[model samples]
Target: MTAPRVDYDRIRDVGPDRAASEWLLRCGARVRYCGQQKWTQDYNNLPTGPLDRYKIQAIDATDSCIMSLGLAHMEGLEHVEKITLSKCHYIEDSCLKRLSQLEKLQKSLLEMEIIACGNVTDTGILALQHFRNLRYLFLSDLPGIKDKENLAHLLKVALPSLELKLNLK
Candidate 1:
């Protein structure tokens, strides 16, 4: 059970078993949800403050459901530096549209990992182009993306320093 308003630092001090979503609000934390629960809806309730860096290693993100709280919640984060979403089976390319609104993350994002997404194809991978500040990217096991030529076309311009690792299997 996650509390709507949590005390992150207090939870951190107590360790992850005692962590809460509120901590993500406190100090720009990094979170990876790989267990049985899905944190997708929680993105909607995040406070209107700049986030630190967050990583969601939802590999095997087995929640076979659509969890969208609307893209309105991403408006407040001005300080988010990185976000990683790997192996989340449910998140598709359309979900990347939500990230376009995060204008502040234009030139400083670190990594974006999208692996084995059932709904994400070339069109979906191309959606990642908006993150102009992205440096490191991992796109393994996606069904549609082909070689670097196609990958280069997806991220045509913007994050010139971008590096991508992909897979077609």
Candidate 2:
């Protein structure tokens, strides 16, 4: 199957947070809106109200097919605090780079977990330096990462307050 396409017109119509939620849900990812307790996973059952009423707070893209291009949906999200990416086949180092460049996410994102994503390497981990407010990071099972200790040390130096956990071999 082809990768899911982003609808820019939907972003303009429903606002970035809602549009991103739709894209993520359509790709089998779950999203938690700010002030909402349950994660929204069904594309057809999306919440209804004012288009701009809900803000995306967290994304759990475990085993989803989200790719580098799909990360564009997150560009305008300003309230996202956490993201978990596990076993996403299409996610790559470039995806992380694209995520880091999002100005709104830089200040709001606090925690991130990258697990079992084969294409991710030290290059992608390093891109997280741009998230100035990020406090916690978890990485595991990424065989592409070659220099674990050095990369960990570099991240420590760059983000002094960050709590990092690694389970690489």
Candidate 3:
């Protein structure tokens, strides 16, 4: 099934968790069981595998009305190949920690943009070392990540072989 077009207004009334769930469902996510509040709950709620037979290749939640913890709900979207979180000021180290758990993205994720997120620090940037297949990464205007030189060095040591195009400023 072709993914449905994202309609922010259609999900504006709900909480972030609900918005994420609505996104998955509307994107033609195929799962065994899915209910209104399933993505909000625990254990049984989160899908262990891909949301659909075909992977959700990309998601751009740039400046979306959602907080850091909201990322937890997206963990179930196991096959995401690219994500853009640019200008989402509320996203911090914790959100990156949550993203690091997406082991499937380690080899599939090709690009990621987290620019202008004020709270992302070295800890968060380090967490991204897991994305071994990442060919492009954008990180700019992050206050928590103060030492650019160190960060560049770290990324080099961490992702030596990958020809990553970095946009860090």
Candidate 4:
């Protein structure tokens, strides 16, 4: 049987699972985003220093449920400057819709990566067009994006100065 889903405090104590990371971030704990390989470990309690000293400026929720809980919880973090939601195969237009609500993302976010989000479509790209100041965007391995020409045109117009790394196959 599965254990009960812990609330915010238990999540902080455990540290670094998707749920725990999301929980800490929501509480303004400023947890750093380690890459996917070490994501499930309890790294928040390291002996290096006190956790409260670090302010979270970035989040890499790669292959995690950013379309749902991540987007919902991140709306309040005005300090978040970068986010990577790569390899989230099920993410779709709805994820972008949620991102639009994050005024923080529109203002402070400089980089975003949505690689391999195969379900994301042109509508999602349109939604991203709103981040006018976004400097860098990376999209790759998206099989569902068929209209490459339109997508490219839209990106050019929407993010005129954006540096893009696209591999939409």
Candidate 5:
């Protein structure tokens, strides 16, 4: 009996690497996710500095894809000047904490905007101080965070020039 044939071309057709890499590359300034993809197949924490090389400008994460933030954070994406997070309530607090590594960037003048994430509080925002180059910030629609003084302290400590635009309204 003959064994079933294997098509190397068909195997190549899946193009998992090409797909993930191209998607991330084409997405400039920001990457938005409204639905989930089977991303874990290619997601790697391995140091491929190319991800950090881009000036990602911004990220608008909403709906089901918010969970992927952990992958983005691990890629050391804070080199981007701005980030907008909305409706990513599924993201864990650890995701924000991951930004602490942004300080390691050679020239880290960046800021982020967070909205509609009910789980992230002022504490999470304050934790961003580790990104010393952060100069502008925005926070809105976070129900768990109770105070700004701590957030103020973080700015005062890490980036005295930091200007935060908070919209609780």
Candidate 6:
């Protein structure tokens, strides 16, 4: 199947955080709002209060259908601190590139995990260098990564204080 299409008009109507939350949920991912304790997983039962009340702080896209094109929903998100991309078959190098280019995410994102995404290669992981404020990165089960040592070293050089863990084959 093709990747999910982004709705720019929805983003304009509901604001970035809510729009992104809807997109992520529709793609079978879970999202945590800035002050909410529970993860919102059900698209039909999305939290309702204020249009701008819920700010997306974390995303768990494990085994979801999230793709590179859908990452555009994150453009205006300013409070996203953590993201987990595990076993997302549609995720690829372009997804990482798109994520790294998000100026707001680059400053707010502190932790990320990429696991079991077969399409992600060293080129994609390397794109994370733009997240200068990222403090922790976990990578595992990504067989496409060929130069693990060099990629780790480069990331270390780019983000001196980052904590990186790799369990690649």
Candidate 2: stretches off by over 4 Å = 1-5
Residue 103 displacement (Å), model 5: 5.0
Q: For residues 1-169, could you state the per-residue lDDT of candidate 2 as single tens digits?
A: 9956778888988899988998899789999999999999999889999988899999999989888888888889999999999999988999999999999999999999999999998999999999999999999999999999999999999999999999999
lDDT per model, in order? Answer: 0.51, 0.94, 0.61, 0.63, 0.53, 0.94
TM per prediction: 0.56, 0.96, 0.64, 0.69, 0.59, 0.96
Whichever of 5 and 6 has more TM-score, that candidate is: 6
TM-score of 6: 0.96
Q: Write the per-residue lDDT of candidate 4 for residues 17-106, one digit (tens) a residue.
A: 344344544333334543322322234552244544333457666655444444444544555567777777657888787786678668
lDDT of 5 by residue, 85-123 (tens): 777766556667765554443144376777788787766
Clashing pairs in 6: none
Q: What lDDT tens digits, residue by residue, belong to model 6 across residues 1-169?
A: 9745789999999999999998899889999998889999999888888898889999999989988878889999999999999999999999999999999999999999999999999999999999999999999999999999999999999999999999987
Q: By lDDT, highest first, what's the ranking?
A: 6, 2, 4, 3, 5, 1
Off by over 4 Å in 3: 1-54, 163-169
lDDT of candidate 6 vs native? 0.94
Flag regions of model 4 displaced more than 4 Å. Answer: 1-21, 24-54
Task: Write model 1 residue lDDT over 43-150, tens digit each, in one string.
Answer: 455433323333333222233332223223333334445455555554776776666546755443567776666677777667677777777777777775655576
Error of model 1, residue 84, in angstroms = 2.0
- Model 5 clash pairs are 29-58
